[model samples]
Target: MKLSSLQAIPRCFHTTRWSLVRQATADDSAEALDAMETLCEAYWYPLYAFIRRSGYSPEDAEDLTQGFFARMLDRDILTTADPGRGKLRTFLLTCLRRFLAHETERRMAQKRGAGLIVSMDTTWAENRYLHEPVDHLTPDRLYQRRWALTVLEHTLRLLKDEYEDKGKGVLFEHLRPYLGLGVEPEQSYEAMAAKLGQSLTNTKTQVFRLRQRWRELLFEQVSMTLDDPSSEEIKAELSELMQCL
Candidate 1:
């Protein structure tokens, strides 16, 4: 579901992600293949970060993440998934964990683009992977945190596009700090207000709207990962996203 539709059901959640899963598991389905490929492109970083935290070098992590998706898509292994028992997040991680433990027997370098499921920028992926925080988080926790972050990043990008499309790009830039990714403005809100030709109160109101929209986006993003998340589950996921920040 799109973020724009989120406000219509403020206290409810629905997701089209299950259809992505269902189609992705059908035999000889191009739609399924496309769905899986899109998901791989969007989510490969979390799997790579999980691998890196498990002591793989950046190069190895890149190879394995690439190779894993290659095998998964080529073999259509997701067809074996049981919709009754698996959430997409758990299913993907379960497959990755198995791939890492027992399925790296193939030549990693050779498998890099073998299936051609998705084109990954290994150079970009490696450079970005290297900058991940060095901390005491276990690999599983790291995976969860990265998953949460990817969701936020996606939401922010969409939000930016929405503002730009509405001719509010400059306002979004100035009010961005109040969206609370811990961004500190180079200048105070008073300065930002003067520069934007908006009163300080108006600036605060715009930021409030941005933040409200952001929370809705976050809820929608997290809810998409689960099959049928309740209000409590969504709230818990929201809390986890906050903690990850």
Candidate 2:
């Protein structure tokens, strides 16, 4: 789920960076909510994959997945998730492990998510589930891949939205080719520029801006989930995640 595409959903709807929120106006609060919802919608699939990888049945996985976010709000988890001690991927894995360890219910499939269900659209989620590669991975490997993918997806959304907000939609899409680079053969920047109808200079600028937004946004996304204020070592950790992607 590209948060860049979630223009349809207002950020005022979800409980996002509320821990850091100090906005006084109603409009600002609404935008924050929308971002929170976008974050939730963007991440559910990767979280679901991790739940399934943890040896839960499909129904169990789905419920546990639902419950995790429920706790994110109902337990004030998001508001106090800590801004420092670890990576968002690490934080999510730890949280998931703890949730799975303590959650002792069987599949009560009908008792699903409560009112916190995100209203964001999701042809992407459906397609992702239908086509996700599930073979050759033990539960552990799957969990790792889920972590990687989740961070990557979140970073993509952040970049996309930054571009859109700056009125560079075409330029944003042009930069996406770099994302799935390994999925396709590598190409020269000249080719990329020509394909996007951009000059070499504009292409370089796009890549530079993309990298900047990605790093800053990546830091924000990952560190905000830590157990401590990771103000000190957060950049190193983010650089590592970026290297993986």
Candidate 3:
């Protein structure tokens, strides 16, 4: 659902996310995968960046992060997500962080550790994760990265629903290259234009619009998470939350 859609839904309670479990189970795998794809687009980068700052080399970070997602899918973690206990974001981050910490030493510097692993374009992941300023990164910086990623993920979902409703799903997919994953210059403008069946100039304009809409949606999502809240309070809470990452 888009943030606009979410806005229309009554803000009955912040602690009501458990209601989502019923909706999720009612849908099939395609629906589930779509939800997950939305999540991956939003989150993969922040987590990758976190791992990098945590001291993994680029390749190892990419591998570990990709492996993390593989486990998420294989184990059907989303299916088991218990939202009634807390916000979905906290639930996801808590699980992922613990899982990685538990397995980090065992995984070591290995190539494709034993398990059901999806072969991501780890090279692509590496390139995308490199955009962050790597100089003198600290734990606090990594938390900030995590917070930024959560905002982007929420934004990406809202954008996806908006585009889908407009029959612009193709545009969302094409323009996504520029937004979430960072721009791939090797992915020629012409290539993206062809994918969306729009002129390169139009593609550029649409992307800007998409980003603006997403920014508003992100602020909205963060606001929803607030209880004893002000925008500044929410931002402070967010900052503190990321530090634990």
Predicted structure 3, TM vs. truth: 0.49
Segments in model 2 whose C-alpha atoms lie over 4 Å from true places: 1-39, 71-84, 87-91, 105-110, 113-127, 165-167, 178-203, 227-232, 239-245
Ranking by TM-score: 1, 2, 3
Candidate 1 RMSD computed on C-alpha atoms after optimal superposition onto the true structure: 4.3
Better of 1 and 2 by lDDT: 1
TM-scores of all models? Answer: 0.81, 0.62, 0.49
Alpha carbon lDDT of each predicted model? 0.72, 0.58, 0.59
Q: Name model 3 segments beyond 4 Å from true.
A: 1-29, 79-85, 108-121, 134-143, 146-216, 219-245
lDDT of 3 at 195: 73
1-245, model 3: which lDDT tens digit per residue? 22222222222334212233224445555655454555565566666677777777876776777777776665667667553443555655666687678775676444654452343566776676566555676744664666665675666877899999999897677677655444543366677678767798987788677766765565556544443234554445455544434
> Evaluated with lDDT, which candidate comes out highest?
1
In candidate 1, how many Å is residue 142 off?
Answer: 2.0
> Which digits, one per residue and each the tens of the lDDT, describe model 2 over residues 1-245?
22232122122222224333312123446666665565567567777766666566665666777777766655655444445444455556677677777787543334755454554223454456547575857655665666666776767877788778889877777576655432554468899878878798988886765665565665566554443434445445544554443
Between candidates 1 and 3, the TM-score winner: 1
**Tens digit of lDDT per residue, candidate 1, span 93-181?**
89899999875565565844565555778778777767877678898888888887888889898888999999989777777776656
